[model samples]
Target chain A: MKKIFSILFVTLLLFSCQPDEIPPIGEATDYIPMLTGTWKLNKFEQIDADAESKSFPAFATVKDLTNVFPGHPYTDFSITFNPDGTFTADPGSSYMQMLTSGDWEVDDTEFPSAIILSSGSETQTIALNSLADVILGKVEFKEERKQADTGKIKIKYIYSLSKTSEL
Target chain B: MRQLIIISILIFGTFVLKAQDALPKFTVTPSEIDALTENVVIEFDVTGTAVEGLTDVYIWSWAPGLNPSEMLLCYDQGSPSWGSISDNAKLEPVAGQPNKFRLSLPKTVTRAGVEVTFNNVAELFGVGDTPGKIKEFGFLLRSQDGGSGGKQTPGDMKTSITLLPLEFEPSYFRTFPAKVSKNDVVTAYLNLSLIESSENQKLSVSDAFTATVSLLDENGTVLLTSEAFETTFTSEKEHAFSFIAEMLGAFPEGKSLDDVSKCQVVFSGKVYNQDESFETVSTKVFEFDFQDYE
Candidate 1:
């Protein structure tokens, strides 16, 4: 009985000494290092707010969106996340061809997680569906037109991004 | 004999006074306005004599396609005239008496300037939301209690107004080497011209301006970009400028310039104020093909 008890204690100690499983990129406690890089859009889709909800494909490539949506002024169609928590983004093509610079923060407390970006007086929060070292997926929230009788309409946009460069 | 002569003079003088009372002299303030303004407030003041028998106010505007002289003939004959004039030219009574009317010109008028004529007519045309240009405008005042149901009445007064012309059209674009050869160095040239403003004012060359050139692939991807070169208008002629881009340097690994099936040169100009706080002027995109330079 003493030998068996001693052997069981030794087995538990060995198991505890082994390294734990590594957490995913965005799920890790220290996730700031994983986000410092240039990212390009890969897919964009929108889910409508309706009883019978419908999913619509918005754009697949930079050129397709520019042609379909005239007056889109962005050319590079990319976002660069810097080590200092600053970010620069080309928000597609527009009449102004303006590039937006802002600050970003990751919120890991939520069920899925979220990334908040603030530019000037505008702030946008994107919910992360999945995150990895080279790929990131988020759901964008939008409010459509409101109906007096039916209340307010809302939509969800899914965005997938791929890492293009490291900083 | 002296009494008879005095009586004749008094009768003639009375007729002349009646004629003067029928006509109302008009004064339109701020005759000029910026070309891009959406709306303009024109104040109308009647001088000379008190206007009586005023009923309706009629306004007509003319642009490049519309003829003011012909429109006047239509009004005189009470015919459906101004075939070329768009319905966007509108008039409303804002201040003074209900008889004192205000003309609400459309945004199109400011972009291209128009001529407007105003008079008092029995019929009133409805206003419109469409955009249109007017070079001259005029108004007429008429009275309901006039001869032949106001048709033969000469009591209505008329006058004309002018709009400032646009300083420039969108933009004229051109490029060199409409085609491209592989591995060749690319050089781009751009030119812009300034036109007279609504105030008949010319744009100053000393104004701070920047010209930027961008090279985009068929996928609308920006492969290369030139610096925002600061330049000034040196001549009234096309403000000529140029920039160079290395074609081979823009290619990715395992690729060459030949892989670029299609490319475009986009040139734009913007004018800013002294402190760069205000961007007052900007040109539309001037996109052209970026051919390979042999």
Candidate 2:
């Protein structure tokens, strides 16, 4: 009886010390409520990348353009995401291809990793940047530009939006 | 001299007129290295370049480091200082091969009047943002003697300095060259960044750090000593002090540099006590037996 009790106690202790599985935080629809606000450009990065590495290319340097052009056009950039599936942007040359007003929808109302935008007949998809403040709703994404013939990525423009204001 | 020039030009003309496959390749062997102590071979084929058909070529090279504005001569102090580096830095033609030449570099080179190890070499070469992180090394090929006409490679030849990240792990105290002659301009390097935290804290509040050197005989008898001199702080965590052994006056005044065998160095700083009084603190004497490179 004593031997059996010791074995049972040890087994119970092992089960108690088992690792906890953390549940994924927030559903895809959570992004909609958190993103319904106007956000200003807080950080802008230009990554000069080496496009030759096959598996994982690297950037030579990441230059911070936050304060370089204090009164310049890009600093005044802002965007607003509304709850009605519409958005407005004042990119101000901050990006080569950006829309001022468009109807938008996220691919996953549950996971919400990419956003699709349409204006008239033109449409584009931009992925969410999970490296920075992605799921937390500060709203970050990067545009990687590639060479025309080679299709190899050469430069990256990373934007992290901050100073959010909700209606 | 005129005949030599005419023959060189003739050879150059013949090589240029021939059907060539491609532009010559200027390269460095073992371009990437594990340690700064490793030597690299700079090789080039002069098939179509301006300096084609030359018997010998001189190398004029400098790795950019310490100062961002200027290039530091890549040759070590033990090699040759600037202005007289031609013959000492010439590239030799590869045996049995027609147009190939190579210059094998020493592990350490003199820069800014100091013999520096490769860790310092990588920093000086402007390859990376910090010491021991080297990306590339570049060089220019030239003639042994400088004048109107000399053989030289076209444009700039660059080679990667390391295949893997050559990290410099600081041991707190180091002497450049690892070995030194009596008159060699010995440099002492002090890195306080990785010292014991408490000792590092004591040095942070000290007025200034100072160093002294003692020349000892083989039996370990101190023959001469130098006055304590303040070291130059090259960076927030790095300091350097350089001296030649023979320059100082001997103990009573006339022992030659050759009589001195072993060399010992000490670094000191002032530390404050609990009573608001300060006392002198010093490193235990670190010594190295001098080599007869002469």
lDDT against the true structure, per candidate, is 0.43, 0.61
Top-scoring candidate (lDDT): 2
- The lDDT of model 1 is 0.43
Model 2 lDDT tens row, A15-103: 99999999878643456667677878888665544312211212213445554332343567887878898988886744324677898
Candidate 1: stretches off by over 4 Å: A1-167, B1-30, B34-37, B47-55, B60-91, B94-99, B107-139, B144-158, B167-212, B215-294
True contacts kept of 2: 0.00
Query: A30-146 in candidate 1: lDDT tens per residue?
Result: 556566687766554333232112111121101112222223422336777798988888765422122368998787633336777888888876666565433342222221223
Residue A84's lDDT within candidate 2 is 92
lDDT tens digits, residues B1-294, model 2?
Answer: 999999999998777655232345667557545324346665777666655666876556543332431123434344444345534355678997767887555524555555654433443344322333333445555565455554445434342233354432356776653445565446676777756554546665565678899999888989988988777665435666766676555565665666788999988887778797887777667789875542
Instruction: For model 2, state the Cα shift of residue A8 in Å.
Output: 6.2
Model 1 iRMS (Å) reads: 21.8
